[model samples]
Target: MIGVIATMTVQDGNGPQFEAVAAELIEKVRAQEDGNLLYQLTRSKADANVYKFMELYRDADALRAHGTSDYFRESFGKLGALLAGEPQIEYLDGV
Candidate 1:
């Protein structure tokens, strides 16, 4: 499986807003993108604004398709101003 682990830190007090948008993005992907196996958003207990996304896709094309999806493009673009720093993405191969 093609996967990605994204680490992000949101601006203070923006965690809830970011979570809401993330939830919407997940729903969109599930409903519209068949190649996406999973898209999950998580938060660190120690830091409320620290977030993570665990995603699983069929392959590179599926991963790239998600990036080009309208929901992702729009939501991710809007999230830039509310983020504390650049998101760190780690691509991986499942065993």
Candidate 2:
């Protein structure tokens, strides 16, 4: 199994837009990606603008598939404008 944690900070006044787009992306990921075990969006309690995508994949192939997915790319492209800076991503191996 593979775990991925991606954190993104939204630009000022862009929270709603970001969440709306992310909601669509999450729905697509869950409905279409069989390799995906978990894909969720979470907001920081301390910082409303800070968000994270908590994800789990079936394996390396699943992770790769997600990376190359057209919908993932397209959704990120839409989210780019709403981000305050580059997203921080961390990969982990399941114990």
Off by more than 4 A, model 1: none
Give the per-residue lDDT of model 2 (tens digit) for 27-77: 999998899999989999999999999999999999998889999999999
Q: Could you tell me which 10 consecutive residues in candidate 1 have the lowest summed lDDT? A: 73-82
List per-candidate RMSD values in Å. Answer: 0.9, 0.7
Candidate 1 lDDT score relative to the true structure:
0.89
TM-score (C-alpha, index-matched) for candidate 2: 0.97
TM-score of each: 0.94, 0.97
* Top candidate (TM-score): 2
Local accuracy by lDDT, each model: 0.89, 0.95
Q: Supply candidate 2's per-residue lDDT for 3.
A: 97
